[model samples]
Target: MLKISSDQALQLVQQHWQITGEINDLPSYADRNFKISGAQGNFVFKIANPNWSYADLDIENAALLHLVHTCPDLALPKIMLAADGSHIIPLNLYDDAGNTLACHMRLLTFVSGQVYAEAAQQTNTDLASLEYSLGLAIGKLDRGLSDFQHPAMMREVDWSISQLPGLIDEIAHVEDAEIRALVQRHLHYFADNESQWRQTLPQAVIHNDANDYNVIVSTVEPDGDHAQQKNSNQASAHESDPVRAHYQVDAIIDFGDMCFHLRAVDLAITIVYALQHAVDISRVKQCITAILRAYQGVHPLSEPELRILPALINARLSQSVLMATRAFRKNPANTYILVSQIGVHRLLRQFEEIGADELEQLMLSAIR
Candidate 1:
């Protein structure tokens, strides 16, 4: 639903960066990934699709604002909002020959970090700390957003994991029975208990995207004359100091999936997508404990908060299946939807684990 022409994207980027450069759509682009440019100091641009409701746009902005205030160590990009309460740029779309946009356009400051995913796949750079520090950062973020009130807020979507069965029936045309069954089984678990709603989940802002790639890690303190040099991704050069070797949070990017939901839900997301990919389950346990402890040191998780972790995670996993299906149906051209396929497979395996039920029980106890 968030489609923009190549030129319009470049225009928004140029306006925000305060520079002039060619803007071409990057090859193999994902739905969320807008552009990768060799602009001044190397720039990239990600714009929200123009079709989102005004309430949705507010949700995006509110998340970014919440993260910015909650986590001082993390830097969020500037949103180019203009007077009259618009995202500054017009919602312009192009069909066969011209632009035909029906929504407002948004601009973002291109972050300067490598997609940790690709770097891990390529350099094999002992990226273990990359995962841990992300945990720490989100732990900090959790404490930051907990207990905040947003009066002028968008109502969350009223859908739930239980809704997946009806959704599957609606999509009976899904010829791939495997995908169909995956949705059915996953949702069966997700929708099992339906009393807890998003708004009822101790309402707090959360970063829905906690994957390794979304985190920007760098040395906490600058070192050496080369500390400022930019790397292949064109981010600022990192330091060589060993004591400062641990990754620290530079900024949390991407606010499109921001929501007012359970603090445990964010943890569930980080566990499934962010931690599962790079670390072993044992290390994942350590990191989870460390992050939770760190978070508790600040805001202190209530008994109810801890009990719902397993279910929150299940809700997230099932949501992934639905969102992925919608992404594939809507934007067949984007490759990002394909990545969600990997997440779906991961979730199924997670549910099959022997510890799965126990973890759910522990989470329930924490809530009690």
Candidate 2:
């Protein structure tokens, strides 16, 4: 893979896209990303990974275009065209060995708002409120994708919930023996229940990667007058009452992992991330219930899907921990991959104590 330099990125943006701006590198798992700010507004410049085939990029671009037309209400990033009216631009670069490499690039209008992960860190916001809003957003996104289809959607990918059982070998990459054992337990559960889940759940085009970092939340300013009035109404309220920040789902980003999968899989992925930072089991249950209720409000989940969700959620967390462990071993210095490692461990331990049967009943009752 050819590493893109700052100078080359700026020149590519200015000369080819006709956009001039201060380009800053953005963190990414594989692809190179830069945010360009100019008078026209901010845009994201993405250089596709060399391993990505033309078919992969084609499906991602097509999905973005389809969303633009069918779901105008969504705050999805809009793809910008090059001077030649091409959605994707090809670039020639030389690697360290002095060999030329073919690289693909594209531009997208940057969506504004704080990423949910960052916002959650700064606010004492209600967990249920945030989960409810996120559920509705994912529900609407999946609904928009119901009629949309592409050949690439059927391609086998490691991130799919169906592929979780196959990742048992990756557990060896995890350094912690306890964590590895926990992952193995979840894998066994998934293998035991795989047949029933496959037969019962409805599959569809799902936004398979709605992790907190990919979901953006619009900022909300606190109202002093309302706060003062509420405090006065409650005599026990003290001056130390923390001002809570409210948030709404602004946009969903990162479609690289989108695919045709069980409809409940999307919910499971979202729930795993939502519960990542949670420490209290009761609070985790509350957040999960709120998310499911809000999602059912938009698109009701079937009983069997709800029953299978606990296993799916466990599998998703196991996948995250295993993948993060592998990435850390390969590039130990990459902090981005390790961001959720601790939180995932905590969540898995808590889930084990709570038990899958009990959790499934809680989730099913939430929608009922």
Candidate 3:
């Protein structure tokens, strides 16, 4: 794969999208991305991995356009068409060995906000409220996309929860034998239950990668200024009572992982990330409940879906640690791959202690 440098990315953006700006490289798993700021306003320039087929790029672009048209009120970033009026720009880069590398690229208006992951770090923020907002936002997004369909949505993706069982061998990459064994046990559970989940859960076109990084929280607080002022007055009246800041979900980005799958998989992915850093089992349970309740308020989930959610979540967590472990083996110096390893292992152990039956009961109770 041809990795474009900051300079190359800037040039390509200027050439294809007619955007002239100072480009800042953005962190990516397998693609080259940059944040461009100029007279045309801020835009994100993304170059798809050379390995990605034209159909893949077409589906992603089509999904973004569909969302923009159908859910105009949503804070989804607008896809910027190139000078040629094409959503995707084709590029051919060369490796040092002079081999040809073909890739697809696109530009999108930059969604201005703090990433949900970063926003979660602020002590003044109400996390329960934020998680609720996240659930509601995702529920609405999924509802909007319910009617949308594309052939590319069925593309094979290793990260898909359905594909988690195949990664069992990756557990060998885990150095800690105890952690590996735990992951293996969960993998076995997922494998054993996969067929039943496939038969029961509600399926739809879902934004599969709703992890913290892709979820953007707008800087604008959801509570209006009146509420803030009221809270401020209360705090002034009693110095001990502090005002907590409430935020809203600004936008959801990165539709590259969008796929045809169980609607619950989206919630499972979100819950896995939300609870990754949870301090205790209670907090983990609380986060799950809060998210599910908010989602149910927007889009009620069926009991069968709820029953299989815990297993799907475990499957997602297992996918994370296994994939991270595999990536770590390839690039030992990359810290991003291991970002969730510690938290994932902790959550897995807690889940084992809680047992799947009780976990399902907890989720079922929340939605009820």
Candidate 3 residue 169 C-alpha distance from true site, Å: 2.0
Candidate 3 clashing pairs, residues 3+ apart or interchain:
none
What TM-score does candidate 2 get on C-alpha atoms? 0.87
lDDT of 3: 0.79
Error of 3 at 236 (Å): 20
Q: Between prediction 1 and prediction 3, which has the larger TM-score?
A: 3
Per-residue lDDT for 1-368 in model 1, tens only?
34566676666656554545656564422233454456344444544454456666666665566667766765656554444445534445544456564555555556666554544443323234444455557777767666555553435443323344455442343335765565566566556644445445565666667766666656443323123211211221232334334344566666556665556667777666654453344444443444444445455666666766666665666566666667677887887776756755555454555266666554443223
Once model 2 is optimally superposed onto the true structure by TM-score, how far is the C-alpha of residue 133 displaced, in angstroms?
1.2
Ranking by lDDT: 3, 2, 1
Maximum-TM-score candidate: 3
Write model 2 residue lDDT over 19-96, tens digit each, in one string.
Answer: 988889988867789999989899999988777777778778888899887667669999898888998887776677
Error of 3 at 194 (Å): 2.0
List candidate 2 segments past 4 Å from native. Answer: 172-179, 221-242, 328-339
**Displacement of the residue 78 alpha carbon in candidate 2, Å:** 0.7
TM-scores, each model vs. reference: 0.68, 0.87, 0.88
- Clash totals for all candidate models: 11, 0, 0
> Candidate 3: deviation at residue 291, Å?
0.9
